[model samples]
Target: MEFGEKIKELRTTNQMTQEKFALRLNVTRQAVSNWENNRNLPDLEMLILISTIFHISLDELILGGSTVNNMTEKLIKDGSETRRAKFNMITTLIGALFLFLGAAFFFIKAHSVEYIDSSGILHENFYLLPTGFFFIFIGIIIFLTTGITFVNSYIKSRR
Candidate 1:
């Protein structure tokens, strides 16, 4: 069942009016109405609060239905484009994070020389190595390549 359905079910089971629930949540009665009708979703904090007030775990409240499982199965079976879009988005985010971390490491190494010997002459800093820059470059390349792949896949799947 969708979250709204669960909310309505729980509310009815407890015999609580929308007005009462709304008051408890510090929201308007219309907001409760909206939630029950699936017109909108509650924010994470409110969702947690609702689960707590109803004495149910978030997992139980959100995912305790065979209907939801069947829906997921159907979506997976269908291989819908929407799923591809979601995958592309996830891959893009992962690639971006890797690239950012790699770039950061590269910057840290490139700037390490600033903290070198007071002699202001040629010296070696064991902490800073040429390999660091190489890794950073590799990271940026991976990020760009992955980003391109994600965009391409997203576009192709849309078609």
Candidate 2:
């Protein structure tokens, strides 16, 4: 049996109405209705709570049928999406930081002193220029890579 069907069986067998079950679970009636209808699922914590309230072991509650597969699929999908979002956010922040650093190094005037050796030849440092260019290069690469991936994913999703 599906999780929703199982939940309905348990609730009805216990002589509890949807509203009463929702009250027991501290959720809304609509939430219970949705669960019973397989529109969505509660989180893991809620699942555990449901098992406890139903006076069933977790295995009995979750493993009698295809509920295990359904719950596993949901968990995997949610985890994957969360990880992808975090990865995108972190990469974006890192790319922005690199760009800011590059701009600072390139545009901010360096205050290094010019040194004259015994030969009286003045030597100036230009390290900041190269460093800034490197930073900017890295930032652009990061942005382009991330943007392309995002666009590709968006296109695939649209299809």
Candidate 3:
């Protein structure tokens, strides 16, 4: 039987409704329905969870009644890698946004002008300058760390 069929059989044999199964998996009922209909395949984590909940081996859950091969491991690895790549991309983008905001603040601070008041007293708005520098420093650190992490992950994935 197919993976979806297997899942349906297991759910029915356990006397659980699709909604109940979805609740146990922390997913929506539609997601469970999709899985059962073979509209989509679950990620490695979800597959592992299903195996654990059903007391079945990953091999059986994934390969059904077929013999084990490198393809099964490859599928799991590819799914995991895709998830990691997406996470790294999001983190890098957030870090870049922080860096840009920090730079903009620093630029604004640099252009601030001092003025002489009616009493001939010089007034300079320097309070925000420190804040600007702090932001710039933090942004640089975050950008660097995130960039490094992305690069490292990329390199590891290539190998």
The model with the greater lDDT, 1 or 3, is 3
Q: In lDDT terms, how accurate is model 2? A: 0.84
TM-score per model over all chains: 0.49, 0.81, 0.48
RMSD of each: 8.4, 2.6, 8.7
lDDT of 1 by residue, 18-132 (tens): 9999989999999989877877767668868998999998667756575563324333545666675677677667656665665666677666654446776656454444555
lDDT (CA) for every model shown?
0.71, 0.84, 0.80
User: Residue 131 CA error for candidate 1 (Å)?
Assistant: 7.3
Worst 10 residues of 1 by lDDT: 69-78
C-alpha lDDT (0 to 100) for residue 143 of candidate 3: 69
- Those runs of model 2 whose alpha carbons end farther than 4 Å from true positions after fitting are 57-68, 110-119
For TM-score, candidate 1 versus 2, the one ahead is 2
Clash number for every model?
0, 0, 0
Instruction: Give the alpha carbon lDDT tens digit for every residue of 1-159 in model 3.
Output: 667788889899999999999999999999989878878778789989999999999888888886543436568678798897787777767767776776777777678888999999988767666776776677678768877887897798799
lDDT string for model 2 (1-159, tens) is: 677888899999999999999999899999999988989988989989999998897776666564465655677778887887888888989999999999898666375667899999988767888989899899999989889988887798689
